[model samples]
Target: MKYSLQDLIDMEHFQQKLIAVISKSGLKRLTEIEHRKQIEKSENRYRSILKASLDGYWLTDTKGKLLEVNDAYCRMSGYSEKELLSMYISDFEIIETPELVAQHMKKVALKGSDRFESKHRRKDGTVFDVEVSLQFRPEEGGQCVCFLRDITDRKSLQDRLESLWSLAQMTEAGPKVLFNLVLEKTQELTGSRYSFFGFINDAEDQLEVNAWSKEAMNQCRVQDQPIHFPIAKAGLWSQAVLERKPLFWNDYNLDHSRKKGLPDGHVPIKNFLSVPILRNEKVIALAAVANKDSDYTSQDVSQVQAFVSNILLLIEKRIADEALQKSDERLKLALDSVSDAVWDWRVHTGEVYFSSRWYTMLGYEAYQLPQNFETWRSLLHPDDLPESEATVFRHLKYAEPFEIEYRMRTKENQWRWILARGKAVERNDQGKAVRMLGTHMDITERKQSEMAQYPCQHPSNWYFNKYQR
Candidate 1:
């Protein structure tokens, strides 16, 4: 239609405005498409990564309803993907308390994450342990993603390691202390209700139950019984000792093939494991476990073998060390009981060592005494020094037995007569004296008594002198 000049301009302007609106609409569409593609790519990558991950992945709503689960999750539960998704997360929980789950969720809500370990039931009605770590995304409508890992094997290994560690700590204690520890550790490791440890008395040639776990010792009626076989015979303990290896018996009572030598009135033995305590290839003790809750496996046997071996070594070392300590104490006591003062000399160095008693008998303590030949020379009387030094030098130079008479200062600072006697007890390969051990006898009283008894002769000569008088 024909219009005014103003109307024409308005129409042109409207046309330009419509073109701009169309261009803007096209750009908006392109942006929307790019955004959608980006979202899809991110989702696909997330799904791929979740499925390929070693840990099981699961998503649940705030109500704990299972929304989705990865293949790993389904596999862990022994269920198909569809089945897991159809089931609520609460359905798999061994604990039915919703309050606990809610509390955990609250923690996750506050911190955005939570982690715990709990028992989970599988599709096959079996139970397995799982460690779960959950992260919450409130922006995603309070959705939670949980990562679950099967830790049954890890838990079992941890338990076994703990048992072994307990055994080791127990064995570190002395034998008398370890007796009960060994029995208890064996029972715990083997899951046995009863266990006993018997040591063979080398002198008596009899077996004695030195230690037993709680009820095992009480239930075991045989103690101090002669070890016989087939009838009141030595059980697994004897067998292990003879074999020097581990023995496992599943259903000892039911196994007709097993020879029965159980004592009368004794409880029937069920599953049993036995190991020997060997020292220097000889079986010194026997450890036996019985009435296990389950059949003993090769793993149990191996663990018991290791346990027994360690126990044996510990016992052997403990006994040897104790004996050595006892012998050393006895020697020390003997040395202390003697009247003479013992001394040790390093010949090559010409250093002298004296016991505490020797130093105390003199006017000094052991540390206060001079440790070299010069110290001894300083202590010697001027008159006796020449004779003593001459005697010692002659003996040392010729490698002969040493004997000398010297004077020493008493605790009262009085001179006392001492007879020193020594011999080279140790020598080097070149026959040179390395060590000289000796003793010093306080002969002052003896010498004075002899001098006081002057003019006394033997009985026959005394009778002749008496008759002449």
Candidate 2:
């Protein structure tokens, strides 16, 4: 159609507008297609990631029935996909029953998400620890997505550390206490129902049963558990000690030539593990656990070996401490019988530990004065002090002989002759004496007799002159 110049311009404007609208719509369509592809890619990636995850991923209804399970979960639980789909969480859960599982599901629904630890039973009935993280989606037909990670090894390590810490704290509690703790911890860490700890006698022919786990004692029907038995008469359990190695019997019920039927009223054994505590390739002690829910593995053996080593150290330390204590007691008795007094001196600190006889010899109550060099100095007779100190200084500096007869003031204000003999017990890095141990004997009578026999040589004058030379 023909029109005026203004009408032509308007039609041209309208054409331009139409072209712009078409271009804008085409761009919008292209953008929508790209967005749809991106969404599909992301969904595929999410599905692939969920399927390939090493941790078990499963979807269940609020009631705890499995709706979908990943391959990883099927493998972890030792069940086929079809079998898992037909079962409920209660079927595989060891810690929580059907009712408890339902309660947990409700709690997760209320909280939207939850994380917890629980034990689960495998298809073969072996129980293991699992850590579960779950999210509930009410919009998705009240379903829950859950991820489970096996934590059996982590839990086992935690148990070992806790047991070790406990045992370390009880190292000084006595051998019986340590032995009982070892037995209890062995059972706890290995999931055993019974355990025992024992040592082989010095003769190497007898087993001295030291302790039994409380569970073992409760279940054992023996009228009286024997504490000592000849190794030759023992059953296969003693083989670990005899062979000087560890022994494991996953199927203890099976007949073996060495299986001397258990004693009457003994707790039935299904599986057994025995580990020897050896030093220099000789078995000194044995630790054993029995009746685990599952077969014992090398890990259990290692755990028991660590425990045995710790117990051996504690036992040896205890023996050394006991022997040292007895030696001290005997030494004290010997000194008392001879009426001598013991003294330990820390030269640098001027601290002195004087035995009770040291005070009693001076006619004073034990520890009546501060045990220090100043106290000894105050008690020394002034006339004998310079000679006595000179002799001590010579001995400390030159490692010369240290025997002297000095006069000390007693509680009764009487000067008594003291025969003092000592030797450096400890030295510094510079070879200087830092500690000295010595004995003191009241020698007033001997001195008096010597003076009476030799009137020209007075006891104090004789000692002073000899030390001076």
Candidate 3:
């Protein structure tokens, strides 16, 4: 216990060194703990971002077997994470086979990173376009990190726009060429394996196939396939024409009621869709496409109907242009063959040419009144004047199709329904129609039939009341 002053100083120094060492060790441990907390926080943020991203994210081995998938990927694929992990790339790769998928994986591994566009099939068996961004991370045991974005809508819009442009360019082409273009565009826009565009005969009993899909032509084995066929023989698919409505049959295979109309070796029909192109409630033409990879929906019907409308516009223009280039005698001859009555109006001179058939169709003699625009105008019923006049001027001014239905006064003082169709055959430098040629078909019987079907719905009944009054 009794010690010198120097001994006490030396003992105090030793105690101070021990305290310093302990303090340093504790500070170092605290710093290490803080670093670990920062790393964990960073990892949590990364995981949250990966989970919330709208684009699908997945990690797969070099062999194309999915190892991990995010919720977005699961939703995009219509499968759960566990289901996706159990599937390989070839299970849903539509554009490639298993061999092709393996080759693609090899290319990605060699390149380290790549971006490409491809199609993928969902669990529900519908296909969609995807943009894949992949990175081969050798550091992470050669696992591939991939991201996919759904581009189905974008790709559809782009294809539709391109189709429209192509159709517009082909408007001046003849009817055969134009119809083929339309059919091709329809198949592309709808993703159908086969398609056809056909015009209904005037009798509404036969369908004349004007254009057909190239795929159908290639796969079909029928010798000398019939270009025209009776509507009754078209089986259930003809309902679109007979019923004057659109038809969709998604499960064509399971429907035993579908008549056996396919010839031997015909391409098997998995699904079918037909949209009637209507004019004044009459099915003048129809477009049908078959065997899309998935079930056809109402959206497809709408798209086809819209496309048909554009096709009609182009067709009207083509007919007008062709008629204008023909001789008057030739044009008259052609009109006489197809129309019950014909009219030619000279816009600048206000003169009109009425065929003898026109007078007879109205129960009048030749030159009964005056062969002028006034004669046609006066015969139009009061209820139909505004729309009839607008349709005529619209075609003259805007080059729109001249097609209208109205009641016209016959010589017997009876109102007869007339389906009037025409075109502006000649236009001046100002783009105004200089001459218009049109045909008239008496459709009183058809109007009466429609009225009999639904008296309250048909406008013909309203016209009859006005005529009686």
Candidate 4:
């Protein structure tokens, strides 16, 4: 149709506007469909992952009511999908308080994530340990998703690690301290209600109750009693100690032989384990665990064996340390008891070693003694210095016993008669003196007593006096 220029421009503008409107509408429809498909695909992928996970997964409302659960959750609880769908999380939780659950949920809601451990009951009423991580998301109406993993085995391992750590700490302490620690740790690790330790007294040849847990000691009245088990007796712990092996008894009441062999008024040994503390292939002590809730297994035996081995080492070290301490004490006593003072001389180094007792006897402290020979020479009386030095020189040159009577000044500046006797204990290859050990004695009394006797001028005078008497 023929039209005016203005009409043609309006028509062109309307057509272009219509085309733009149509294109915008088509684009919006395509975007909406793509977004919906993406959301669906993401949801499916999440569900698939959750279902395939080994750890159980659950979605709950803020009140902790279970809204959805994955296959793993159902499997862990031994419940059917339909059954779980109808049940709330609180139904299977061993926690009785709803307030605690609310508190846990509140933490998750506030922080967006939380983790905790709690006990969960199975369909058969058995309780198991579970570690749970709860994450809060705003998109799903603020629902919380929980990731749960069974941590029973992990807890057991942690307990074992703690026991081992305790044992290591105890090893550094003394024997009595270590024995007490062992008793406590054994009761804790084995979940035993009672435990005790007894050591064999070598001189008395009797078993003595060295340490016991409070519960065990109370029940057994072990404090006043002597723990005597005859080697010929077939007692559980006695036999284990003699054989140097671990012994385990499950249902001690059912074991008639053990029941008959047990001592009178003894605590009923139920689900017990015992191991020997061995040294030099002989049982020196016995450690026993009693009244365990679970049946003792091979693992228990192995663990007890390891613990007892460490105990044996600790005991042996303790004994050795005690012996060393006693020996040191005896040596000190011996040094103090002697009337003479001991001295050591290093010839090559020209160093003098004096005992504390020597210094004290001389009215001086150990620090007063100079490390060199000059100090002693300075203290010698002038008259005796030349004779003493001559005697020592002769002895060193001839490899003979060193003996000299010298006068030394005391702290009071009085000269006292001292008999110095020494021998070269160590010698060089050329037979020269390398070291000398000696004793110094206060011989003033003896010399004065000798001088008190009547003296004869000559042999004829002594014989003439005797003939007259």
Please state the error at residue 460 of candidate 3 in Å.
68
TM-score of model 3 (CA atoms)? 0.60
lDDT of 2 by residue, 24-77 (tens): 999999999999999999978987898899999888998898988888888888
Off by over 4 Å in 4: 1-48, 51-56, 66-97, 116-131, 139-141, 149-174, 200-209, 220-226, 235-244, 256-270, 277-284, 297-299, 339-355, 365-469
Predicted candidate 2: what Cα RMSD to the true structure?
Answer: 5.8
Least well predicted 10-residue stretch by lDDT in candidate 4: 459-468
lDDT for each residue of candidate 1 in 1-469, tens digit (9 for 90 to 100): 7899999999999999999999899889999999999999999999999998889998988778788888887888899988887887668888746767777677788898888889888887666689999989886679898999999768766766786677567544788777776777777666778877777665324567677677854665775744322312544445555555777778675544335457765767767887766666665677778886557777667666666666666777888888998997787568767778888789788787776667766767655767776777777777778988887767766866687777765555567778999887887888777887889888766665664576353222332233223
Off by over 4 Å in 2: 1-37, 59-61, 66-72, 97-113, 135-145, 214-226, 345-353, 367-398, 404-419, 426-435, 443-469
Lowest summed lDDT window (length 10), candidate 2:
460-469
Ranking by lDDT: 2, 3, 4, 1
Q: Model 4 clash pairs?
A: none
Off by over 4 Å in 3: 1-16, 60-67, 86-114, 134-145, 202-206, 214-234, 242-245, 256-266, 328-469
Instruction: Name the lDDT value of residue 241 in candidate 2.
Output: 79
Query: Which candidate wins on lDDT?
Result: 2
Compute each candidate's TM-score over C-alphas.
0.60, 0.76, 0.60, 0.59
lDDT over C-alpha atoms for residue 272 of model 2: 91
Candidate 1 stretches greater than 4 Å from native: 1-41, 56-101, 115-132, 139-141, 148-174, 200-208, 218-244, 247-256, 259-272, 277-284, 290-307, 329-333, 343-410, 413-438, 443-469
lDDT of 3 by residue, 47-154 (tens): 789889999988899889998788988888899988999999999999989999889888999998899999999999898899999999886668899999999878
